[model samples]
Target chain A: GESVGLHLPTLSVQEGDNSIINCAYSNSASDYFIWYKQESGKGPQFIIDIRSNMDKRQGQRVTVLLNKTVKHLSLQIAATQPGDSAVYFCAETGGGATNKLIFGTGTLLAVQP
Target chain B: GAGVSQSPRYKVAKRGQDVALRCDPISGHVSLFWYQQALGQGPEFLTYFQNEAQLDKSGLPSDRFFAERPEGSVSTLKIQRTQQEDSAVYLCASSLAGAWRTEAFFGQGTRLTVV
Candidate 1:
């Protein structure tokens, strides 16, 4: 079965530090990659997405870097804040027949102030 | 109206009971999706509907989980004979089919607890 997996289950960082979460996907056919943030008792919110053609995409405070050769994806958060603490998930789309996304086992990011 | 909306923000059902979850997508949206999220895990794909036509439902866990998007608008996810493992949050998302990319807008989600 095709699946996406995260390198770390949890990451703890200081409020002002930079945070980097990594994901490894098994499907190379996945053309679309997305990063989502989920707070407690809330649904996953779309943060940033990158197509296979692009190796890097930047949002307001986050950046998604894709490495197709290694099937690795990463989300980088700059100047992490307390409000940025949440479970971050990396999902891949366009791999399967259906336009559904394959999500990874989220990485919980704890920003300690 | 603004984004995807799900009813019965929380649900508590006894084992073997049947439950129905509702989702109201944004007006004029053409794609709707349902996902199940377990504790400490990301949302798992469940089913998808494109303008009332069920394009795919391969991600449904079992036959007991049924979803319908009648009239190509409001959708429902029904779980029959629910088990303890069925306890999770059901999320509904919608996207514009005409768009080039599939960027889903998710609802708050319905938390189902099977005891």
Candidate 2:
């Protein structure tokens, strides 16, 4: 069975500091990966995504690093803010016909001001 | 309208009851997906629809769960004889294309509580 799991259940960081969340996926066939942020009582919001062809992708204040050799994915947030406090989930999808996403257990990020 | 919309932000149902959750995807979107999320857990795939065609429903939990996208825009997920274990948040997402490379936008989600 394919599974995606986070290295940490929760991560606490200072508001002005940087935060890094790690994820491990078992499916090497997964070509598309996405990082999503979910606040309380809200749905998973897409933050950044990277294809297997690329090792790193950067957004406004976020970055996603994909390591195919180790089947590891990481999300890095710069200058973490209170508003960035939420549960972060990493999802993966392959090039199958369905292309349904497989999500990992989320990592709660708490920003301490 | 602007994004994926789900009706009944919260639902409370007694055991053995039936419930239906609705999802209105963004206009012109070709792909619609349904996921279930438990407390403190990531969303799990339930089903997926592409232009009224159910491409994949292997993620459906059991036979009690049924989803339909009649016209390819609005979808309904119906649960029969619901159980306490069915309590969770039902999320709907839509993407412009059905390909894996496209990004999907999610709705606020409907919280289902079975007592």
Candidate 3:
């Protein structure tokens, strides 16, 4: 029953506002989770990541929260800008030596100016 | 150092044709990864390489998909007898594995269109 999913398929918010993207994963053994932002015709870029040992991690203008009990992960973007518009994905890397990443469905975040 | 680089930014091939995509990871990076991104979809892991050894390749869809990082630096993904369903953007990522943990750097990607 290992699966990764996004809570919302799409999200829209006004510029300068805060945006929260949520994800749910069923793999309890997963130890590392990362959020990536992918623009059109581009590769997914790393945003933030959290280890299973920790519940939260923060990066420049971005924060990631992990809740192992509910298998939930969330990314909070502070002062969302129009340039932040892209498809956000949650990927889990664990369970083996390869540390292959298992991706979620994704949420297309559209920043409206 | 510069970011990861993937060649053949765009490639079009017939259904039965075979195609090779190249990836030049960041200098000194010991971990290499390959992923495929379909239109409107997230990147799916295809394989991973540590140094010159491919530690895992369970994500490879089929035997037709072959990947190699002989020198532990540059890598290549070859798809034999391409199919229409194989069309997507191939991404390569590199990470420095050591005491200092860091994020993986991605390449622009190679978009392969199979007709």
Candidate 4:
């Protein structure tokens, strides 16, 4: 997510290495959390999602960790590939119907070959 | 074999012009959503539809921005008197149900540039 203020944080990593992108959410009531990968000019693609009930969830090469006490979330990608280069976003769903998503400040992942 | 499909993948318009973006959600999906993504930001919700009924539109930026899903299968987002700030990629997504089991599928999105 781009800051309403200015500029987005960036993450640089080498191919075949592990990459970790972190986010700090503002809402403590946010129960449903999701991680989305957005490439340039494209909509966010769902990477994986985890509920507040669990602390960790793992996918093929990706893992999401949630720390409710601190309202923090993190996505870890193993063996990062060039294809992984994109903006990573963490979304939260709270409040009510429509289940609108509130996104966090995004991190741009630049993978070096 | 089909995901959400959006029309006119790209749109360029002068300020004060009117623009319409179209989205065709997957068949049988009952929930539809519209979101706007600026530059490198995460998508911000604009509106949502459950079938032909617009359940929520509070996210719409202003009255100039309107959306309709009359048939429930296809939806359209119209921006009147487009401003430079309206330039962004509009995305559409659909989901079957929200019981925390079904996933939402998103379209490629329409890139709107208001010069």
Candidate 5:
């Protein structure tokens, strides 16, 4: 399960298990959202994204679910592997004044063997 | 270039010193962005440039921070009167389109430490 808050959260799971990461955005008008995975000493790599028009989108081994009523987003990894270990971030864009992604604190996903 | 590239992977500056971080985005990227990531935090938007025009700089934290992209291919982020609070990893990203329309590629980032 995933918890939503301002502080960074940690999700530890077995290599073959499933992992879920969560984020709560502040703006209600946000129209787009993205999930990024960042390895240590490296830049963020895009994993998946969901627009306001859709409540759920599926990618290879990953799924993003958006709950507009709660203004919440979640990323689920299927059969998580050690290679998936990294800090996962959820970013949002209201397409308003800034037109920039407003990123959440991030969640550290650790897959233990 | 094959991907986004940043210079001087690591930097340490005195509290009052000024520093410049550079970003070489992917070829033909129309949108370039600068972000600041503090320890254990996700990247925060600083500024954005569409080609040579700086369309958005509203994310810059203060007057001490400035960014420029004169020719549209490369960009620079400058910080003046750096303080301890200024220490963070500066990340640069670029996309094929403007705003939130596309996925952005990111550079490794420059770790700036103000001592």
Candidate 6:
């Protein structure tokens, strides 16, 4: 079965440091990927997204990198802060008409001051 | 209104009971989606609708689970004979368009507890 999974279950980072969260997906047909941040008692907030045509995309203080060859994706956060602490999820869509997202187990990001 | 909204932020249902979760998408949004999130796990796709038409329902766990978006706006997810395993947060999301590249906005979700 096709699955999207994280390389690390949790990632602890010092404040002001950079944080990297990684994900591995099995579906080659998946063309759209998104990174979402979910805080306690809240819905998953969209952080950034990338299409298959592009290998990387950047947003405010965050970046998403995609490696089609390795079926790997990563989210990079610069200057990690306490507010950035949350469970991060990587989701993919087959780019079909339905465009239903398949999510992976999340990675808890803890920022230490 | 501003974003996707779910009703009854918290729900407690007895085993074998039925529960209905509601979702109100943003105005004029063309796509609606339902997902189930278990404790400490990411949200899993449940069903999807394009406008008033149900486009995909393969992710529905079983026949006991059903969803509807009759007007292509407000949607509902109903669980029949709820089980303990059915306890989770039900999230609803909507996108401006049904395109594959569109971003989906999510609601805070309705937390369902089956006891």
lDDT of 6 by residue, A27-93 (tens): 8998999999999899999999999999999999999999999999999999999999999999999
For model 2, the docking class works out as: medium
In order of appearance, the predictions have TM-scores of 0.93, 0.95, 0.92, 0.93, 0.94, 0.95
Q: What fraction of correct interface contacts does each candidate retain? A: 0.56, 0.62, 0.52, 0.42, 0.65, 0.67
lDDT at A106, model 6: 85
Which consecutive 10 residues in model 1 chain A have the weakest lDDT in total? A1-10
Q: Per-candidate DockQ versus the true complex?
A: 0.46, 0.51, 0.43, 0.49, 0.57, 0.52
lDDT of 2 by residue, A41-71 (tens): 9999999999999999999999999999999
Model 6 pairs whose backbones collide: none
Error of 4 at B17 (Å): 1.7
Show model 6 residue runs off by greater than 4 Å. A1-8
Report the lDDT tens digits of candidate 4 across residue range B46-112. Answer: 9989889898898899999999999889999999999999999999999886435345778999999
Off by over 4 Å in 5: A1-7, A97-99
Local distance difference test, per candidate? 0.89, 0.91, 0.87, 0.87, 0.91, 0.91
Predicted candidate 1 versus true structure: per-residue lDDT over A1-113, tens digit per residue: 11233543788889999999999987989988889899988888999999899999999989999999999999999999999988889999856655588898888888889
Worst 10 residues of 5 chain B by lDDT: B97-106
- Model 6: lDDT of residue B80: 100
How displaced is residue B44 in candidate 2, in Å? 0.8
Tell me which of candidates 2 and 3 scores higher on DockQ. 2
Least lDDT summed over 10 consecutive residues: which range in candidate 3 chain B? B96-105
lDDT, candidate 2, at A1? 14
* Per-residue lDDT of candidate 6, residues B1-115 (tens digit): 5989999899999999999999999999999999999898889999999999998999899999999998888999999999999999999999988865778999999999999
lDDT of 3: 0.87
Which pairs in model 4 have colliding backbones? A1-A106, A2-B41
